[model samples]
Target: MSTPKPGKIAAQFMAHKREMRLSPAWKALRGNDKLVLERIEEEHMAHGGSTDSLPVTFTDFQEWGVRRAAIAESIARVEALGFVECVERGRPSRAEHRFPAKYRLTYAHGPKVRVTDDWRKVVDAEDAQRRIDEALAELQARTAALSGKLKKSAKQRAEDRALQARNAA
Candidate 1:
């Protein structure tokens, strides 16, 4: 094959060094987690390497083929693996204040920034998996607790309404 043009290659390709691809942390990433990280990296590249605060939304990841249900967990896994750092989490509370989550790729540094290779801390695939599992377990417990509280509050409201109706009668 003929030699490819540098400009075309640079414009079209996002490079992952062989070492990074071979790293335990990278190896331990599930498919969805890799997709999440790739979407974030694409956003960073689209911004011309300004890795400071790359905003990537759930919709963006979904568009890139990450399942809607898996997006949150996948993002969390990638962060836990140290491939990305969440600078600001998105809030969906109000339309006027709504914003996408911002992130920084740990291996890619912006201007005047040094690379923070957090993934290197993971000694092996098992270590990476352990960290992910622990994070997920904690998240699940917190979610369950919150769900219980919400159910209790809803039940209380219903009981209060019934009492109010009886008094009115």
Candidate 2:
């Protein structure tokens, strides 16, 4: 898979902002939380379909102008909202270097929720009502025409029967 570009990642994030905004958890997120989320998303996107957890460091957030304390708080808040999951906590041992903490996005990672069929019905109810009205009008016209033909046929049959009776008499 091609690496996810920053431009592509930003575009995707912007597209889903509306749906994100609607979520209370997302709305409650602070600037630092947003920064952390964005950084994680960018890394995830760059990873390009890798099921493996993304490796990130506090320096990553620092580079983005987020403070260490803010990163910790943001991570907590993000994890609380079920948006970011910390896969492995990197151990910074004095003797050896360890991998940065790994993370991933939860189900809320995709583009914003769209108008599903049920919502579409509610939003376009008036248009649907108009179409139903047109169909009813067509049906009414056809019914009127059919009823007129039936009446004519019945009247003709009565006349024929009466004539036959008169002739017999």
Candidate 3:
């Protein structure tokens, strides 16, 4: 038995995870299946991941040089493994529901990682330099306070001496 190409393997991984999430068996497992999730992400990234798509389509597999037989056999094995399922969606070819379905993974078993709006912002080069300047100014003020620890305003010095005199009594 020959191994499937990386792209097909990645699609298989996504299909399996999606099936598991929608399963009652998954709830019973209590997320002891985190390792499986990790492995899927690893394999997916290995085939050049991006912010583009998930469970790469059959056409993508062809583009990546996966042999036709391997693609068909892998798809069949994946379906047999309960990873892929038939659902009613309007596909571009054949009957309305006939297509390699899309895949999704809900990270329900762990802490969700959020992509921050700051990351999405377009940061100008000059704004970055301004931030650096402001941070440096704050650092300089703190340093000055530490270096002049013994120095005080007139009101402060008078209060200190009065306190010292009262203590001496």
Candidate 4:
């Protein structure tokens, strides 16, 4: 038996059948979500077909034509649908401390790993939509709460500065 070429292997892995294309989780993916998935797959392929710990940064997605604002949500949506899982959550801290998130495509198997088709759990379109909607809503709520807290802290700091100035005078 002969080993398949890299291109042939990648094409086979990336290709989906018509039935899979029509599946609820697959069909529910938006353009950005699909782009995010593709970008991750590209990264995986670049790393010699390693499925886990594939680092796909926001900038990478942006270069692939995904909007900056949509990148996080797209990642979340794909994750919610079980197409990928974040193994390490990246933090946007100081440049020295910054790290891109690492991901694993659930459907792709590595030498020692087995495929986990988590998307198969999604029963229908409505179920897939509901899962994505719920995850996004929760994310929005957390973002809003954090914004509120930040605003409160800023206001407190301003008041402290004003009081200090009055006392100095």
Candidate 5:
């Protein structure tokens, strides 16, 4: 077989990490955790790792295997990614181990979260929301167009009726 591409390998690695490695499950959850963290950093212009610094918490990150390690890793990774890190160490004896080190959203990496080239212009809450809104608007517009097309089919009945009348006449 031809040599596998580097990008393909990297993508596979990332997919596996998301699918298996990270937990609490929401540790890598898509938007809210992802987007909210981004917003907090933009607002602060600095890494806000503590509750005092950053206002948001890792809302729904659940506990899983090697719970303590997972929380710490999540914090470090989130921090490394330039988002605020919040750690609330849950009681050791508590059934849930991932309780204490609660992660929070902040400027994850000190004062800089890298915005991808295309995303630079729209790196704030408003921008992110706007992007979503624009997409939804496009979806709505397309839906409306589709509805209009469907409505045209109703006219087919009228055309059929006229055709029959003409044929009879």
Candidate 6:
């Protein structure tokens, strides 16, 4: 599969938008399923993810005030229609313990067409990057707190020592 540049990715995303608008599978989706898919698409675009894959979190759907189980069912319905798929399971950070599954979607998944290799690569790359970014962000957050604790200024250190000495006296 070729590594598509940013421009090519944008073009592909536009094509996907066109295809999604006209796709029979998308049309067949129920109202809730359609809403979920649309939100996923919006998030994919917002995050610069490939048109074929989206990183969707439960929190992303939280704005709709929907139940988690209902959202899962909606996703299942979309997947059953071949309108979307969960490409990767999310790994949550220990601190926040929030993880959202990654999804892939395309008009090619319509009954009439097959997902091409190039599109698959785009989806895969987007999912991988999402995972990497999540891991890095978690690591940075964790280390940031630790680093702050380790870097005490001389005055702060002196103050702490003086307090300890006073307590002992």
Q: How well does model 3 score by local distance difference test? A: 0.40
Runs in model 1 deviating more than 4 A are 1-13, 112-114, 152-169
Give the Å shift of residue 70 in candidate 6: 1.5
Residue-wise lDDT of candidate 3 within 1-169, one digit each (tens)? 6777875652322334454544433332212123333433443454444322234445555555555445434433222222222132223456554464343233212123222212112144344335435544664685588557646576689999999999998
> What digit string (tens of lDDT, one per residue) describes model 2 on residues 1-169?
6777865652333234465455555655678888997788677666653544778888888897788866765676666554666789764545467578887666333333222212122224354345335544664686599789999999999999999999999
Candidate with better TM-score, 2 vs 6: 2
RMSD in angstroms between candidate 1 and the native structure over all alpha carbons: 4.0
Error of 4 at 83 (Å): 0.5
The candidate with the higher lDDT, 2 or 3, is: 2
* Residue 5 CA displacement from its true place in model 5, Å: 16
Candidate 5, superposed: residue stretches over 4 Å from native: 1-11, 15-121, 165-169
lDDT of 4 by residue, 15-112 (tens): 45465577799989999999998998788767766557888778899999999999889988998898888899876767577688999888765574
lDDT of 5 at 142: 62
lDDT of 1 at 81: 88
The window of 10 residues in a row where model 3 has the poorest summed lDDT is 113-122
Per-residue alpha-carbon lDDT of candidate 1 for residues 1-169, written as tens digits (9 for 90 to 100): 5676865653533667678889999988889998898888788778878557889888899999999999888877888888888899886646666589898888875564347888888899789989899878876896799789999999999999999999999
Q: Which residue pairs collide in model 1, if any?
A: none
CA lDDT of every candidate:
0.83, 0.63, 0.40, 0.83, 0.41, 0.59
lDDT of 4 at 164: 100
- How does each model score on TM-score? 0.79, 0.52, 0.25, 0.79, 0.30, 0.46
